[model samples]
Target: MMRNQTSSTSQTIRFTLIAFGLGVGLTTLVIGGADDATPIGTKWWPSEFGPADERGAANRITPKKVLEARDLIQDGKIYQLGRLYEHGMPIPGKRHFSLTIPGLPTGLPTGNNQMVSNDELVSGEIGQVGTQFDGLGHVGCRVNGEDIFYNGFKLSEFGNPYGLEKLGVENVGVFLTRGILLDVAAIRKADRLPNGYVIKPAELQACLDTADLEIRTGDMVLLRTGHGKLWMEDNDTYGEGEPGLGLAAARFLTDRKVALIGADTWAIEAVPHESDELSYPVHQWNLTRHGVYHLENLDLEELAADKVYEFAFMFSPLRLRGATGSPGNPIAVR
Candidate 1:
């Protein structure tokens, strides 16, 4: 047999226990924080790195601006700043010998054996030769400890499983804009910047001062170190030891929001540090982290000698979908 107590205090105690349990359930509803089920508006927040009042709004130059620049060039006041490719000049790092691929046919088909052609149609797999611009997608940092696209896209996501349809060389669009050439070598009083010599931030500023040119938004900055000539010497020591922009220099350029930064050298940054543990931090910082494009192996000797600092730049890269990079010939007219 059981005895039942129907007192007001007992009823109140029962109600209190139920209330406490309800309070705990409510607490969890409040403290769980916006889960996947939470409304999107409830989780919205302002971006931290967005444009500030002092800083101008983020803007991109339109095609009309480029066309306006071209119109300025038509005023008959611009000189072309690009190297003429020669047949026998020594290709960098390949010794004094000129470009000649063995087992490759040469000459056009003419006469009896019309089916065969000897001409190496200037096509096929030719290691990027001559002045070239490195596209933004050229090099990338490992994302999540894996070689992935900068946009978090997997490498495999490009193209069809076995065919070129998915990722073909036709994606990189044309680029035309105003170009500013910073003649660092001339300012340094040296014919060529030495290898391993890190260009300091102060020196870069000095070069800009000497040039007396202002860097505008959406401009491509080309830094001439006189190292291109050295590279053309075809000596291993040339590229093995050459002066290049330091990490600070790269930072300075990117801070200006320059669309692209180019140099007349193999790698825009100084030689790899002595410690094997240290690698190309500039590449990781600018190209990967900052979204800045790096243009390497530009031939700027002619332009520097001409003392042409401002120019209209034009370049079109092969639109290779999902390609790490496309070879480009960038021309500067001033």
Candidate 2:
């Protein structure tokens, strides 16, 4: 039988789970900055790791945490939690992803051995396409005519076309921690949520209550809105605004100390944003302010189908030095 998602079940979580603190240091930075897009006069510089640290929330994955996560793998079953990178996979404005080969047998036999090989040319936003991981440098805001990134580092100082000098995807180490899949779709008893749906804190809390789950500190929390069902079926419709966490939901999750947030949608939060003026406030709230990470365009259907709420989430972004993001297949083991 499925876990009963009723008010009475809330006590199940409260009784079984212990509150975990964000063990990582959180040293706030005082910088001069103000914008309608960001918190007024707020900054996350002089990070807990130090003023120059770049790993962000990844610091929460300690050796002890890894061992704990390892113990969760009892059945040795793994669920591939990433979308397939292809020609039409719901890309947003101006972003692109394509793979081509000049010819099936693009290579010719040059040596006497007569070895034939096939090669393909790949290009177009690999870091942010398909199943993508957003880095600290992926999003930032213009502050007083200066572009600032995570930890309040100036863009002029670290931004480079070739690669970032600081806050690059290379800085975020591997993530092998606890993962919780919040099946909001099942909670709503719907195949998929309507576009532009804003998930409120009460809904989130109630979903946790329904799932009999708790959001532990430093955990990688993924929200399955059932949007992945449209992944390859209707690319255009999927590209449109999606149902996801609202700005309020972002604040609530940040307070819970989740190290990362993933979703089947392109953007982790609601598109068109809460206020017309804000584009990606949640990105700024987590990636910049609270040092949290984001994994987008995931494939959580298997986990949801099996009702696997908890697992050992594992992902190691490609060490693509200075890239803003990384594309890879994250896995969840139960």
Candidate 3:
């Protein structure tokens, strides 16, 4: 049941069975209650990193992990897994991305050497746009009038109009770890998984088995749905719902202690989510509950085509003091 991305909230509750499964899993025991799908105000914080921690899953990138990843780079072939941030690129919802040169030559010749330059007046959610890396502060749960973020930090206490005091993207250091790409589209023998298609643990496991690969702790897992094929060609279709991981599948990765989850889809989790009671539950689960990061809107076509299931994945989020997220190109080395 692929729902339009612009559909109303009430129109998305088409999967009662999936929604029920979500409730049965990590969510609350009750299924239909307001707080059942993703419980609010419960004790899901103080993260494993401790009360004051903000660096989330990047904490898993130990020196040993770096060495492990480095060993996978035999050929030194690099795959850029980010899309171009230009106009007409599909942006989720009302988010905008625009880059313009203020003038033909923003700067005139200042010296005898003729140093003319064109500066860009870039606007629109720099951190949240393009190939975005969601930090800990990007999503939170509202509990009884209070917003709780990763480590159970209160939004009222740390959030500022200027920037957040905690869980800033800057707090997350570099990520260099073994990467595993599960080409679900190929395993399913489809060019692209249908919109609203929920990828479960079974599908992920099947892909791993087919590739003779197993996910390891601290690994960066990426999914290729083939939806990225629509990237610039069909912006309208791309902005619509997408196929991605479901809650149960996400739990599977988090249980393996994965450092991050990324996908070709704009939202790594399925749209018209498994539960109507929840919106982007996977985001809340990964970022807020488990301190795991998410890499969205990735470009994985080349990797999928090459059948590069294993590689060294590395990315460093911009050091934007208190930004909730960062946009940049994450690379995979083979």
Please provide TM-scores, in order, for all candidate models, with all chains considered together: 0.66, 0.86, 0.90
How do these models rank on lDDT, best leading? 3, 2, 1
Q: Write the per-residue lDDT of candidate 1 for residues 97-210, one digit (tens) a residue.
A: 244443444544568867543433244222234444444344443432344323333345543543233212343345578788888888889888777777767777887788
Model 1, stretches more than 4 Å misplaced? Answer: 1-61, 71-129, 156-169, 273-276
Candidate 3: which stretches are off by over 4 Å?
1-20, 27-41
lDDT of each: 0.53, 0.76, 0.83
For model 1, give the 10-residue run with minimal summed lDDT. Answer: 36-45
**Deviation from native of the Cα of residue 186 in model 3, angstroms:** 0.9
**Model 3 Cα lDDT, one tens digit per residue, 9-119:** 332123234545564254432333344332432457667888888987889999999999999998999999999999888776677888899877999888989899999
Top model number, lDDT: 3
Q: What C-alpha RMSD separates each model from the true structure? A: 18.5, 9.6, 3.8
Please give the lDDT score at residue 15 for candidate 1.
27
Instruction: Sort every candidate by TM-score, greatest first.
Output: 3, 2, 1
Per TM-score, the best of the predicted structures is: 3
Clashes of each: 19, 1, 0
lDDT of 2 at 25: 21
